[model samples]
Target: MTTTISYEQAKAYYEQWGVNVDLALKQLNQIPISIHCWQGDDISGFETIKSELSGGIDVTGNYPGKARNGDELRSDLEKALSLIPGKHRVNLHAIYAETNGQFVDRDEILPEHFAKWVDWAKQNGLGLDFNPTLFSHEKANDGLTLSHPDEHIRQFWIDHCIASRKIGEYFGKELGTPCLTNIWIPDGYKDIPSDRLTPRVRLKESLDTIFEYKTDEKYNIDAVESKLFGLGSESYVVGSHEFYLSYAQQNNKLCLLDTGHFHPTETISNKISTMLLFNEKVALHVSRPVRWDSDHVVILDDELKEIALEIVRNNAIERVLIGLDFFDASINRIAAWIIGTRNMIKALLYALLIPHNYLKELQEQGNFTERLALIEEFKTYPFGAIWDHYCEISNVPIREKWLQEVQIYEKDILSKR
Candidate 1:
């Protein structure tokens, strides 16, 4: 059937359930997903003095045509953005600073170092987010940065985070969108620690120092990311979830919940509503975890849909900050971004198309049988048709047609790289 016919048929089915298909499409268009720049280069930022990949973060598969420099990364990102529907933001790390081949350490990075990124963001009409690189450095070789025992090393990381917030502020000021400056440190112990309290104490102190050097909240919003465990830090992660959640509440900062940072059974979908209740705004690093905290490409799985449903049903779409955070070097990097981001948007669209109010009424009225039946029946609904129409209207390729574009780019651009 033609796309228009399928979409028309699908609209009638949704309207029967009191779903406003057009409103859903309009709302989905306005939600911006912050795409991570590290995906383009396997988190290998454009730092002159490169360090080994540490902090339990690992990107496997040396896929050919991975971005080699800042210009190449931006070029690749532009291509990905072209394929993705709706306006989006790009998240950057402190190590992506362009310093003319000068060995500027993390602590020394300044907003001026990222002036080019700001200019590029302006040109692309994209907002920018920031992260302070806390791993893969001499200071964090022990897998302890902000919580390092050495006061000097701790101070260095603190300075870097402070500097990163300023850069985030610069991005917001230049692009007219507040930057989400998040700090994710791979600080933990490889095995059972005789002392966990001391390290967390130091971490808390370091964060206090960093947050003390505040930037305007109107321009830059600070966030603290917690991890469960990493490659080396299997037993203890200094920045535990409880730690950051409480810290965010007390300090009025944002808590960044990485989907992969929690245990396998723990889902971020369940935590969203709880976080929403306490914090004015919560941040998310949406990712898929296979067995462990592996940064796998996101798929439109049950959890992803439930996450979108929670955000939409609770009317917390604007309050929750959503960002993509997965890096897979095995397949085409651009394809990875396209697939992950498209799935995220698709999940949001799916949630928007659902008759959430009716479902809630069913639950509230204890109509469990009907609720289950309706929910299951909607799974077979013409969601794909609505999605295709959305892509058609948004001027992006519908369905697997986008794969051809990726293949063409791979052959024409990526193969040559």
Candidate 2:
């Protein structure tokens, strides 16, 4: 039976569910949260909230400058790193090359700048998460193709992979943890299919080169396979489940699934199951998906709320790395970061409160149908009241603060109108 309920109906059902909102809050108080840095504004400013929530942060993607060469980037990162709670650690994004863009000359990167990155990371007691710019294409310029057909293009990829490996080796040899080289190839088809399978094959070959380099160096690499649904008919790498899984297995590489990459076309629970099946070879990129756009919004929607909670319930939280891949030119950077992190943590609280027993039962005896029903039941569950109760108990004093912030935001938006 297709059980459909309106938002009000769902909220009402949640209110009636024998769900002790207070107890739920108490339960949520026990879990910790983490935020991705690109979506966050000022890392140092988040110190107060991070301490209150006992959460960590992941400094990744296009945030100010976490590059290997920029002196100002190093200073900014150092300042941000110092602000994190002693108990909660920070993860640094090492590379800065933009995807689907021009090739970055490796020689332009000063080796001294890279060595300085290693020094800062080691001194701060922080961890490293690497995202190398492997794909070389023109930005704002569509109809770009991988350069493998061009000798210069082939050399670019090779040299990029080699430089990335050297960086990883530096981390492994000095820091004791191999840099988690996160891979996301922007290579894809943009027009009529010339050679559908050729790009995929070439992309895999490029990945294999990196994999071989990492293997030889004995570095622990996590190949973050990503997907984009036909940007104007050009097929992108890591576009499908089968493609990702097959490539990972064939290359003996681990997989990183971006939650936002999947749409309504694929069930979130099914994706979770895939991760569980490939638990040994899988890590997750946690973010919210909205229809076709990888909105990178905070995970606040009911469907994703339930799926995220279920994954944590099944003991898969550690295997997942929380990241907010959000980008919007409208909001000031700091405000956007604060709101995004707040929303993510709030969503995480809801996930953590799902009764362990319910999850365990589904795991042992429930079929897909039964499990889905349980999820729906939880989705309709009232969580705002529970969050309020937690605020009271934890003495966070932020319920009304957030409400006021929302009001101001609304006023600002209306003023623009």
Candidate 3:
């Protein structure tokens, strides 16, 4: 049922086929994009950038919660929300305790803080990115050790899932928006090539529990956030196409693809095809890829970028949830967020310029050679323009304004740097 096409054929079709620029522009504007949050003390810079790009933020991983009570968290959420327009949405991460490469029990999580976060999320219109770290130490530490797979950890994961289910139920009863659970299994292989079969079985067991817990939910409940690993030269799990697709098919779960997670060996089009074969149950965490590092950089149009964008355009699946998974180690946290948001918006605009019908034909045929050829043709078209034309058309003015303000801020920060 999979189609194949050549790169050249894809290019010829794109060159010959006319694209509806206006329609593409409108669709691009409507796409929901978010920024990943690691630091959350002050989101002012993110807010400013959101205002400019007209996108939302996805608060993931660890975030600061120095606030004293639910009201304080709520107040912080409101301030963050106010930065973006009503059309944009925000998702918050469930806080977990980690120590020395292991997940501390739920009892270890500060009760008052936990309750505050739950209540704050309910009071505000934010969604939750429920993590499954209680089940494994990968997110907390780094690698997946198969020989010493934590069986004791399974119970903790079950407890966390049940607790999250309760939170979701509470949200449904109180706020009418279903609490969302996102599972990103950081569990994978390290050195010595551990028993892959055992971890795979455990991964299934954990997912089954999660599915059972949320099966009766009336609203959106769970998304399997699939990741490919990159930590120096270390090997990680869920890094291959076969592994990801097989997991999704086996669990009957929607697949969430992180753009930067894939190794250099994988192809984006192949990933998209897998998602499409599974009824378009795919949500994307879109970011740029850097070799040997999941830098989560801003995506822009180059040859490879065009191919990636083409896959999405041709697929045309509406369930896609776009978010940026980025990190800001330098400068004030706010500025990092702003820069990240601006870059994402620019990437979206670039994607909009792709010739959809041409891509669709190539995808339908599943021809890699034709696909590469078309990509080359696309490269040479109009002086080898990829995303630049769309960027010029859509983001130039906003970027100019951002530059004017950011330059001054950059100078001040650089003086400190």
Candidate 4:
């Protein structure tokens, strides 16, 4: 645990640099990061017959204690939320429908399938974000949806997307917060295809159909996500970043940028400023990518800092919707959740404590030399002390102390399962 005197001294040190630790904590508390539900169960929802993990989605570990049902998933989420400091929202995919033993296909899914989730979120005082499960279905056997050649198959996915939005609206109305219903379809091909334009045209038309219904944005907001490539769709992905960027701009909808969905060399931080410049709202799916779209646990690395810095420095924190989209079944699920969520909060707080305007002034005046020096200097500016203080204020365990709780939970709760 961080000592009180040490934290106070660190606060005093930052105070000399004109960074308000109190203000940083207040800003960090206000941001609600949506935690993805798929993390608890490796994207395996409570279906009587399990669906094959297809559509460019695959989890590579046989880690024990994976949630077997909706009840277990919710219980795991509760454990995770207890360890994480701030109140956050829960992100759910349509596949996580609690159908109560009755099998519900993707297209035929209704709001009632998610009634239990809504109630759970309501009771927990956490907002809900939804995503249409466009993968891992019989209809997605060809690794294409919405952009599929057959009209019947495309219509089936369109109906599923429509149903998902309605469910999102229901969740929003019930929870009294606008549910962000994000659509991400893994429609692509492995080998090179001759006619790429036709699939894209089909995809555009299908998206148009999905957005035809005018659901009140107050209840539910729509966001379309893009992918550069995937496990199977390596050669060509239909919903490329360019496609969704253009679609989002033309249709006045929010664009979702998943950190793991882009090229390994390209970070999502660079796009934050550009997206906020063009759109009224932008959404994010924060995940660590290991060479490919391998959903690794998020760490407090330079990419995460850059991402948080862009949002905080540009004054677009409120306009940007932050959500974690990681699925690592290799470790304890609860620990993974706590670690990622805490790291995300820490990154945001680190960004909040920075004197961005002061640095921007140096850049604007063409003082690059001093700007570079101060950038390195600010990195060592008592962030750890401020972080411990923030954790103390938030009433969660400080640093590795949280891990002890996770270990206890694993022994008592997870081991029993």
Which candidate wins on lDDT?
1
lDDT per residue (tens digit) for residues 298-339 in model 1: 999999999999999999989989999999999999999999
The models' CA-based lDDT, in order, is 0.92, 0.49, 0.47, 0.91
TM-score of each: 0.98, 0.65, 0.64, 0.98
Residue 417's lDDT in candidate 3: 33
Candidate 4: tens digits of C-alpha lDDT, residues 299-319: 999999999999999999899
TM-score of 1: 0.98
- Judged by TM-score relative to the true structure, which candidate is superior, 2 or 4? 4
Give me the runs in candidate 1 sitting further than 4 Å from their true place.
none
| 369 Cα displacement, candidate 3 (Å) | 14
Ranking of all candidate structures by their lDDT, best first: 1, 4, 2, 3
Give the root-mean-square deviation of each candidate in angstroms.
1.0, 10.3, 10.2, 1.1
lDDT at position 84, candidate 3 = 31
